[model samples]
Target: MIEPPRFFSAADASIAVSHLFVRPDMLITLGFYKRKPGLSREQFSQHWREVRGPLIASNPILSKYLTRYVQHHCVPSNGWPNVGDLEYDGFSESWFDSLEARKEMHALPYFQSEMIADEHRFLDMKATRILMFDNQVVQVGRDYSAEIAAGKA
Candidate 1:
């Protein structure tokens, strides 16, 4: 079996994470979630798009740490059939300036209580998964970041 070449300390891993990725300007987190048992997809979607989105917007502490936030609703696709474990109801992508900033946001009282309960209303926390990474911009057909930020998009 293949094995690690050498032991890695947290500092070593942190340095690699910052420099190894193509995009280091921001750290992006993808939170994949499954609906709570007995909750319908429509109900989950409505609550996520309506209640959760607005809740985050209203919370200033969350906004302080989040540079960008987006939600992705899972849709049926013919290319790949949904299979067990691989199926997720939806996912959220949020960008933070640093790992410490994200951690601070999570530790806030408002996020720990109100946010946690709100998520529990429609999500099975046990089935939720989180992944963090930096992206590589391979190609862009359209550029809209500036326009969108300026409220012109």
Candidate 2:
């Protein structure tokens, strides 16, 4: 089971609060993938964005069930810490109105076969990971240091 984030009272350090609220009606799936062997990261990202993204967006059934879709491409940076040899090429997020909608979408033969087949072209299926959750936005800004320092956030 997925554990909810823990909340604590500022006045009492020992006090623990639970905020387990989630949008059960909606389902958001995040898919992380590493490019298939022998394929350059550029090739993988381009194919996903140019070909796969358009294909999914144009699908009538998929477009109907999917509420939102986003692609996150990883960029190499020297400042970031390197953890072992494992590297992720990118990730994609798909949001559905409900879990039932997602189930109905997958039940379609086109989604079950064609979509899966297309995914294999650029993605290393064995190295992919998928997580389902409801997204919660806490903050959105460039500067939150002041608020954090004052304990207002």
Q: Across residues 1-153, which tens digit of lDDT does each residue of candidate 1 receive?
A: 222123333233222222122335566677888999999989999999999999898777788999888899887565765744348889888888777778799999898998899989999999987776554343435555556567676
Model 2, which residues run further than 4 Å from truth? 1-24, 80-86, 139-153
Report, for every candidate in turn, its global Cα lDDT versus the true structure.
0.74, 0.73
Q: List the candidate 1 regions with Cα displacement exceeding 4 Å.
A: 1-25, 78-86, 141-153
Query: Going through the candidates in order, what is the number of backbone clashes in each?
Result: 0, 0
Residues 9-89 of candidate 2: C-alpha lDDT, one tens digit per residue:
223222121332224466777677899999998999999999899889888889888988889998777665784433789
Q: Each model's TM-score, in the order given? A: 0.70, 0.70
What's the distance in Å from true for residue 11, model 1?
24
Report how far residue 105 has shifted in candidate 1, in Å.
0.2
Model 2's TM-score against the true structure: 0.70
